[model samples]
Target chain A: MQKLGDFKLPQFFNYPPYFTLQPVRETREKQVQLWKELILEYCRTQKIFVIGLEEEFPLFSNPEIERSLSHEAREAFVSALVSDGRAEWLDKGHRKCLILWHRIQDWAEIIINFVKENGLEDSVMTVEEIRSGIESRGTELHGLDRIILMRALKLLEHKGKLAIFKGTTADDEGVKFSI
Target chain B: MKEQLATFRSQLEEFARKHRNDIRKNPAFRSQFHEMCAKVGVDPLASNKGLWAELLGIGDFYYELGVQIVEICLATRPHNGGLINLQELCNLLRQKRKHDREAVSEDDCLRAISKLKVMGSGFEVITAGKKKLVRSVPTELKKDHNEILELAQAQGFVAVDEVERRLSWTLGRAIDALDTLLDEGLAMIDDGHEDGKRRYWFPCVSSISSVGADS
Candidate 1:
């Protein structure tokens, strides 16, 4: 019943061993799987795009249980998600990770559908606008991370579904949708 | 004091030379004495003051043997020839409330036998029913047939089994006396191999004889 910023945490989040990396292979596999699901679910709901292994991540510890995952345990869980292609290491140092709760391909498809439904198939919008503008306000695209929005735009661009161009401030990128 | 010391030394030297001649001549008693010392793990003639003191501490070995002989004699009843093994003899001696009572086991017998071997005197274990029994028949009673014999100028035949019954001592003491007697060459043994018949005799001691007839 634990909720963090409107993201409901699973009942096992209170389990102390859930924070500690289990040593036994079978138990650890289940433990890692549960962590993977919880991480993805939390990121998807909270629109969290990046997780820094060395930095504090609210999902890694539960104050109620006074339990926290060690750095090794955090890396193990993240590495499991990375190996499954559900997440990717954002840097070679593996300190930062980009969670793909919805894959780039899935996000590209959603973008295409959103454009068609909005009747803006050939429309142009700034990258930042797509992330937080009025058109995306009620959708999963609203208030999303710019890096993730860029990755999803790039996926669409590769399929000739859209074109990305740099704008004036480096904060604004132009996305022209062919769909 | 010097003149008195010289006199005492001469007397001691003279006595030593006389006993030395007798000790060298009597090989059997010498060997028995040597064997007993060896059995007790003592060096007999080692002039090392402490060793000699320890050996002398035993106090008159032959006298102790004689007392042992008498004790074993009275300990066994006439009937049973109550078979006392080495362990039992040691226990009885140990329980006498004299000296530090060291319990002797079968290993002590082995060590004693090793000493006997060193002294050129040793014992043979008796055999019963084709089995070499652990029971050792002393040399004195080596010729004893375990037969019921008449005591010296006595009335009735001495029953071997009754000796076992009458002796208040443990059965182990009787066997040890028989062992001592066997060692002293007083008893004869049949080894239980001839004609499946059991017999005992005294070849040297006339005091122990058949009750009625010569046979």
Candidate 2:
């Protein structure tokens, strides 16, 4: 029943060892698998793109249990996600993690679906507008990371589904969809 | 007398060969057949090289079920710490084999588990209080540990005082058993409760499994 701002946490979140990394190989592997799943799910729903190792992220600590994950445990978990291609460490010291709940390939699919649904195909949209414009206000593309969005756009452009045009500023960069 | 026994065995084997499909398809029929075999002291599933085995092919069936049992045990070992309730194991086996025509009874599961003894000392069916538990790990659980686990079955957890008061044991005996289970990774500690007493939770015998397994 525990919730982090309407994000329901799993029952095992209250388990003390969930904070302390397990030493047993089998137990630790399951624990890590569960943590990876919960992290990705929470991020996907909350639209969280980044996690700071040193910061007081809500999921990293449980006030009800008075237990918090140690720095080592945090690094170990996000490092696990990084190796799985679900996340990436932004710095050398592993201080920050960029969570890719949806892989880039999946993002491309979402983009195409969004264009088709919005009847925006064969039309033009600026790069920044797609990120925060009224059309994308309630969609996943809204508030999306610029790097991931651009990568998806570049991927689509390479496939001849769209064309990218230069603009006076990065925000004004335009994309014309041929699909 | 020996000649008469031989005749009976051959006749029973012939009957089993005829009803092999019924034995494989019906859980109730299979249990009754196994019970009947037990009464006559006829080893219908003991060996795979005999005319009886070839006639029924039930030996391979049991072996296949044994492998599935091992896989289920290993997959759930982390959650239950290598121990699982017998009925629960059977339920999971049935779920895993849902596509098959046969409904797997607990008796069938027990027979399959017996066939798995050759794997090692790791597979065992031990009685914890009144409940039967299948222990997949080679970890030796003493009588006190079994009693502790039995106590934990009620609430999925036990505190030192609860163990001492319920089992009428001194504090030393309870702590020793709890500590052993904790060392085995069979139990987890919870010290965050409002009462401040450390509650030892046994996941193996506990009825409640974790949620959020949804994709």
Candidate 3:
């Protein structure tokens, strides 16, 4: 097993074929599936919300074997993720991708549970505060991406479980939980 | 003589009909049959509308094989150009003909490709030492190129110095042949040797196991 910054990588990460894009159809399909799983697992554990295609992403290359995914292979794996709704291309050029380790609906449910457990069901908190708040400490919600948090909050608000309103400053946003 | 020839023809027809299965299944038996046909002044694969063609359909058989060979060569041309090893070509042909009853041999492939020569595409088998390679393109391989390829067969590859020493050719002659082979994609250049000698590898003549290890 290879580890990247405390994130344990799978044994297949060392397999050379995992780095090169396979030309055979069946083999390529299996390779893509494995890459998708590894990418999602790595993102979820490392709290990585976005991946830049051209940037130095740790999971994309292995220095031990001196093998790295080509641009086409990166696009292929990310495209597979996009098709499955596990990831989305944030830029028109597909250079940037937003990985959704947890679906928006699942994130909303997690937020509701967090608020209930913290006794903030009827209380208000700034969007930034919920991300790094003491109440959310030691939880997956802590240090989460603001974009994902807002989407989850908006989902909750649609169900009449919360209300999102901007603070005095245009950049500052706050959420009121009716749960 | 005419009456004897007619009797011999009838006898051959009977022999062919009796051993038709053996001719198709066994390459040695098929070659023996071809020899017997030649001995009796009969050309089994001469034409599609002849008595031999009507009896054994050998002409049609080779014709079908020629079409398949063309297909395989065209399909693999992008990867290996028009030059392919006879064994590799036969393996691919076998894979394509998995459901067919006929077992193809190198002799069969040679015969089929020989038939393809009439189309003016320069289909022929060139011997590199003990190995046989099928060249589908019209590129005429001169004496120097043949010598180098044959010399490279001992090992999977050859250096220019080795070619010069073995063939007693000047450095320029060896380089010209090698450069032509390189440009034609028949040989691959390797510059990673410690002795600073450039190695030219012939993928067609090299054994599969050794190739895997080298790569």
Clashes of each: 46, 0, 0
Who wins the TM-score comparison?
Answer: 2
Chain B only: TM-score of model 1: 0.27
The 0-to-1 C-alpha lDDT of every candidate, in the order given, reads 0.56, 0.83, 0.80
- Descending-lDDT candidate ranking: 2, 3, 1
What is the DockQ ranking, best to worst? 2, 3, 1
**Candidates in descending TM-score order:** 2, 3, 1
Model 2 quality (TM-score): 0.71
- Residues A7-94, candidate 3: write the lDDT tens digits: 8776557544456565445445656877998999999888899999999999888888566788988999999999998988988999
Residue B159 error for model 2, in Å? Answer: 1.2
* Number of clashing residue pairs, candidate 2: 0
Off by over 4 Å in 1: B1-215
True contacts kept of each: 0.00, 0.28, 0.00
**DockQ (CA atoms), all models:** 0.00, 0.27, 0.06
Docking class of 2: acceptable
What candidate 1 keeps of the native contacts, as a fraction, is: 0.00
Candidate 3's C-alpha runs over 4 A off are A1-179, B194-196, B207-215
Comparison by lDDT, 2 against 3, better one: 2
Q: Which scores greater on TM-score, model 1 or model 2? A: 2
CAPRI class assigned to model 1: incorrect
